[model samples]
Structures are given as C-alpha cells and as structure tokens.
Target: MDQYKLFLQRMGLIGTSTFLVTITGIMLLPILTQNLSIQDYGVWTQFQITITIIPAIAILGLPYTMVRFLSASKSRTEIQEAFYSILFTVIFASIMGAVALYILVVPISHVLFNGNVGVGLILPLTVIMSALQLVFVDYFRASNQMTKYAVFTTLQAYMVVIFALLLVLMGRGVVGAVTGILITQTLISLIMFTFVLKQIGFKIPRFHNLRQYLTFGLPTIPSNASFWVLDASDRYIIGIVLGITSVSYYSAGYTISSLLTILTSPIYTVLLPILSQFYAERKIRETRFLLNYAIKLYLIVAVPAVIGLSILARPLLYILSTPTLANQGYLITPILATGGLFFGLYCIITQIIVMERKTKITGNIWAISAILNIILDVTFGYFLGIIGIAIITLLLYLTAFLITVYYSLNYIRCDFYVKFAKKTIYAAFFMALSLILLNPYGPVNIVLSGLFSFALYIFVLWLLKGIKTDEIKFFTGMIKESLVNVYCALRGL
Candidate 1:
C-alpha cells in the first residue's frame, strides 16, 4: 500500500508537470497560425517531423537499452559505465547523422520544400540537439529522478514557445522558428549533460558491454523508425500531394489529437522501470496486476477524452486555430483522437514484449504496419485528400494495436476488463449525446457544455457501476490529503 501511494505521488508530479507543458503547447497553436504564413507553418511542421524522427531513429535506440540495463546494473561502477558508454555511442551517432543530413540537404529539401535549402541546413543541429536531449531525459527516468525530469520536460516546452514565437514574430519564418528550437535545445542539452556527469561522476566511456547494449537497442531502431513513419509520414504525403496549406491544416488537427498522449506518456515513464523490475524478479502476478490496473486507469480517462474531443472538435479547433482551420480541420480531430487511443493502448500492452526482451518482434510488427500505413496514406491521400489521410491513420493505429496485443498475449496474458470497458462506453455514449444536444459554440458555451458533460459522464458512470466505490475512495483520499496540505501551508504549518 505504501509503495502504491508512492507510485501515485510520483505519477501525479510527472503528470501534472507534463499537463502544464501540454497546455502551453496547445496555447501556442493558435498563435503560430495567426502569425506565420500557412506555407511557413507547413515548413515548421515538417522540420518538427524531422527532429522527431531523427532523435528516435538516429540514437540507435541506446536510450531504451540504457533504461533496460541501467535498471538492473549491480554496482555503481557498472551504472556509470553503462550510462557513459551509451551516451558516447549516441553522441557519435548524432554527429554522423548531422554530417549525413548536411551533405544530402539538397535532395531532401527538394522532396519536402520544393528545393528550399535554408531549412535543410538547420537539420544537422536540430538532429544532434534532439538526440542529446532525448538521452538525458531518458537518463533522468532511468535514475528515478522525477523532479529533474519534470523540470527539463517542462522547460523544453517553454523554451520552444518563447524562442520560436519570438523569432517567427520577427519574420524569420520557418528558418527562424527552426533556429529558435535548435538554439534552445542545444543550451538545455549542455546543461543537462553537465548535471548527468556530476550525478554519475563522469568516467571516460568505454566499450564495456557495448555489444550487449547494442543487441538490446539496435533491433528497436526499425521499430522506432516505423512508429515514426506511422505517426509523421502522413504530413509528408499531404505536402507532396495536396500542398503546404493542406499540410498545415492536417497537422493542426493532428496536434490537437496528440494531446491525448498527455495522459498516457507520464504513466508510461513510470510503468516501464517498475514493470521491468517486476518481470526481472519473475513476479508474474504483480506484473499482470499492474498491467490490468494501468489499462483500466488509462481507459478511464482516455475513453472520455476521445468522445469529448470528437464531440467538441469544431469549437475546440476554433479556439486553437484560425477560422479557416477551425472550419476545415475540425473533422480530423476525432479520427486522430481515436487513433491516439489505440496507440496509447498499444504503448501499454507492448510492455510485455519489452519486459520479455522480445523487441525484435516489435520491430517486425511495426515494420509491416508502417508499410501498410504508408501505402494507405499515399493511396487514399492522393485520391481522397486530407480526410482520407486521417482515416488511414486511425486504421493503421488500430492495426498496430490488434497485432501487438495478440503477440503480447502470447508472451504474458492479462485480463483486459471487458466489463469495465463496456461501462465506460455506456457513460461515453451519454456524454456524447449531451454534447450533441448542447452543440456548443464560442468560449463560454464550450466551458459550460464541458462542465455539464463531465458531470453527466461521472453521474452516468457511477449509476452504471463503471466507477467502483473503492476507486472513488482512493481518489477522494488523495484529494483530501492534497487539500489538507494546502491548508497547512496557508496557515504556515
């Protein structure tokens, strides 16, 4: 019980911090649309897609290997050795990746930007910065340093908004925005690297157990790359087939939908090492219990999030984007939200494979799914346009979820709580019905509608026995404790 409370506290800290960052990002969307030209915004989006793909792919998955190995390392010396060795390996990979991007900027620019070479020059720095930052953040997670992790994660979001927005306002366009990100990330990476070295007591990284690290991390390269393809390649297809404005519209909806990750990712960070240790100790019952509880809790939020976002897509987009986008792009939200739901579920279930060290299977599955996603994106996108792209994304995510869950079951089985899911669906249907009837527009209406919908959802869920008494007690206890703490602080303790 104590351990469970500690876990919840840590998750609460991480989740709350990440929620602030997510809200800041959501706030930035309308500002960017209002300031930057659609073409420039499209360019910025493409650059973002590059950084996301590069860091996830270029580091050779060493960050993940670090989490797996460092979690189990016996001695302090072993920990330092594993950390620096993986760190240096990634540093070298980043440099090589930067050089390759610099050399091949021409052809890539041609594909993405109709031969706009300035933006391509920014890739090298962006790639290296992204890689180093990712390594450090994962290092924080592996070391169980949630405070440091939350600060840096939130800092990155703020830095991008401040620097990038200022530059875009100054007429730097895509180049300026990309440069702002590059500069901010480089600075943060340096500071984080210094902190890591101080904590770990820097040692010159060697090849100690390098092969083992690569053995665990290398196969994940394809999986990471494939997941990138599944998520980001649609932007490219939209750019090539429809043009930049359409890409801007598509990406806006995608961004809003991606907010669903705010609920899943923090829990994911908390879950990985815990489950890894559980599996390592052969605590099969505990692992299964955690997995079932996690799925239920995640769905408790995510199911309603999907339904609410779908019902409120238009007004939400209006509030977050330009009028043109609010009109045309609103439809993409529900699709991406649904896709995100599947993707989040996949993230949870795929832990079985990771814990079992059957990562090669993940790579194979995502690879096949990536191919299918690309084919569908290009085919349906060309004929049917952005709407087709949205549908394809949802379908691909569902495909990945089904395939992963099937294989994950083969490895280690756990109950999925079908009864709980049915109750959630029942509650969500009533919420959707209410939202449709309210049909909110503008800010005040949306807020009122949201409050009503939320209360109705909870009331319906409680009536349906979807939310159990014990679950309610658990949350109420936490809330009461929080209020008492606040009161004590106010009274100067």
Candidate 2:
C-alpha cells in the first residue's frame, strides 16, 4: 500500500540520521575520552543528566499535549493556531525558567554542589535552549514533517560533535563541552526552528485554543515530573552520597552506554505522531498491526544487540573509555542495553496508551516505575557499587514494559511476548550455542564468536520459519516493484 511505502520512506530517512549519529559518536567519543579528566568529565556528565530535570518544568508537559493535540487537528488553520500557542508557551517558559535559575543559583548551588556555584550560571542557558528545542521538535513532529525533522535532528547532532571537538581542541575544557551543547541548541532554535515554524503559519498565542492546550497539558506535569525526578535523583543523590567522582564514573558509563538509546530513540519519534493520528481516526487494524510489528522488530534486533553488547562490553570499554570509565563501562554496557530494550518496548506501548488518552494510566505506571528505579538504584548504588545501580535501572525498565503491556493489550493484537519468544528465543539460543561450539580463545576469536552467533541466529530463524511470513512477502514484493520501477525509468513511465 501507499501508506506502507510512506512508512518505509520515513523509516529510511530516520534510519539514516540514526546511522550518521552513531558514526559521529564513534568518532567524537575517543577524542573526548582521551582528552578529558575523569572528575571533570564526571562533572560534565552531571550537567548532562541534570538538564533532563528542566523540561519537566520548562516545557512543563507541553510535549505530551503538542503531540496529541497538533496531530489531531484537521484544518491547516487549526494546526497553525496550535503551533502559535505552543511557540508562545515555549518563549514564555524560557524566560521564566531563566529568571528562576538566576534566583535559585546561590541557594540550590550550595545545597546541590556544596559551593561549586558555576553550574548555576550554566543551568539557565541550558534550560532555556532545551525548552526552545523541545517545543520546536514537538511542533515539527506533530506536523508530520518527517524529512525536514530528520534533517534537522541530523544536522543538530553533527553541529554538536563539531563544536564539542572545536571547544576541546581549543582547550576550553569542561566548560567548552557544555558550551558546545548550548551553542548548537540555540543556533537550531534561531535558524531552522523558528523558520520552519513560520512556514506552518505563525500567530501569537490566542485564547481560543489556549485553554485546550493547557487543559491537556497541566495534569501530566507531575507525571512528567516523576520522569525527571527518577532520572536526576539517582545522579544527584549519588553525587551527594558517593562523591562527585562517583557521579563522574556513573555519568561516563551511562553516557557511553546511552548511545544505544540515542540511536533507537528516533524511531519512536517518527512513530508517535503517525500513531496518534491513526488512533484518532480509529484505524484500529492498522494501529494494532504497527503496534505488534514494532514490538516484533524491537525484540528481533534488541535481543541480539543486548547480548552482543554484553559480550563486547569489556573490550568496548578498553577501546573507547578512560581508566575510570573503562572500569565502569564493562559493567554498565549490558545493564544499560537490557534497560534500553525495555525502554524501547515501553515507548511503543506508551504510544499506544497515549493514543488511547490513557496518559493518567501511563503516568501511574511511570510513577510506580520511577519509584522502583529509586529504590533499586539507591539500594544497589549503596551496597554493590555502580553495577548494582546499573542492574536496578534495567530491572525497572523491564518491569515498566510488563506493566504497560498489561494495561495496553486491549489496544493491540499479536500477543507480542508469545510471538517474540516463539520466533526469536530458540534462534537466539542456537546463536549462543554456536559460541560454545566454536570455542574461540582471544579477542579475534571473541569477535568471530559474535559473528558466528549472529549467523546461527539468522540460520535458525530461517529453519524455524519464524522471520514472519509477511517479511518474506514484503521483501519479494519489494524486489518485484524495484524491477518494475527500473523498467518504468527506462521507458519514462
């Protein structure tokens, strides 16, 4: 169908961006790891984790409203109105957040940082830029401008990498690193963000649609707050309890491992607006199909990816990280990958929940999940060093997937847990079995072991007939279409 083609096109664009980002990361990280000191890098990472705390306040749940509201708008005029309202909201919040940061800089600085007050000045700018960027991003996504959205995200990433490298080589140190992020975001907001926003038609925020936006947004503030709380509380608490060095190790480990999330995150970004619209139109079959298919694709890729990362974590740490990070990275990689898989599943399920306007339900799930994260992260961080913390975070995410699936099953089909296990488990098991058979002894052997494992996994999938009958049909159809298209190109069809 045309729709399926469109989805593939969107997926390709987004996938390209993801790949570019991964490559950029592969290039940028070694330089950063080699250049920066562990404590300074840790402090730098604290800044990174700390910023997630702001959107909870500054965007103030506007993202959730923007996705749901702007996606459902039918008329161009109505969508325009929503964009203006959101723009005004972004600007207003930016100013307020900046001012609040100015006010709270001293007291909270002492409390959180124990007198290292410079992070205070950095907070306001980062929060403002983040606020503007979130609104800009959400607006574009809600408008279904996938190609431009994809380009913007890609360029923004490249810009960050370039700037960070420039800053570091200039000897600006940690401040330079943070400056790179601030500069990239601000430039995007000024250049691409505001312009494309105007193309969709700009107006000042008006009273008419304003109430609906706020009505939709306000209740979820605490729910979103819970996410911020859960994310930052661990870092902040660790910084406080385990010392800044602990924060640094944890931060570095998390930063390196979180590239997996960054790569996969955009797929969810592409799916949400489209999914919301499908749900709004009551296209139940298509919606259910995507939901199931996404889950299947995630399991297929994520399982092997997780195992492979766990297998490679020790060497990956040695190659890509500093002494502090290398030590922590080996332990963190698998745990983070496992958690990342769960989070990916949660995103698909949560999109279903969001589409159904069951945000309150989703919120409660996040809240309980956040609490679990806190208890486990704190307990683990305290008793077992950071590995314990890592495991706890992974467990919480898996738990959330379970909770979300339990709640959102009515909105989807193809019991994914069943489909996933039957399709992939035996295949994956055979892959692991291949590693035992080969019995490679060194890093080259280990690398070969992973390669053989993947080959066996694919082979078993072929043998079991579990690659989804639809996938074969789709591939064959694609080949046929390609030949026809080539003929048409020759004949000017």
**Which has the greatest lDDT?**
1
> Which TM-score value belongs to model 1?
0.94
lDDT of 1 by residue, 40-149 (tens): 77888888888988888779989988887676566888888888888888989999999999999999988886567999998888899899898999988887776677
Candidate 2 Cα outliers beyond 4 Å, as residue runs: 22-26, 107-116, 219-232, 410-414, 417-419, 430-453, 468-493
Where model 1 places Cα greater than 4 Å from the true spot, the runs are 476-493
What are the lDDT scores of the predictions, listed in order? 0.82, 0.69
Clashes of each: 0, 1
> Which residue pairs of candidate 1 clash?
none
Clashing pairs in 2: 42-248
For each candidate in turn, the TM-score is: 0.94, 0.87
Q: Which ten residues in a row have the lowest lDDT in candidate 2?
A: 484-493
Candidate 1: lDDT of 82? 87
What does candidate 2's lDDT look like per residue over 161-184, in tens digits? 889899999998767877888899
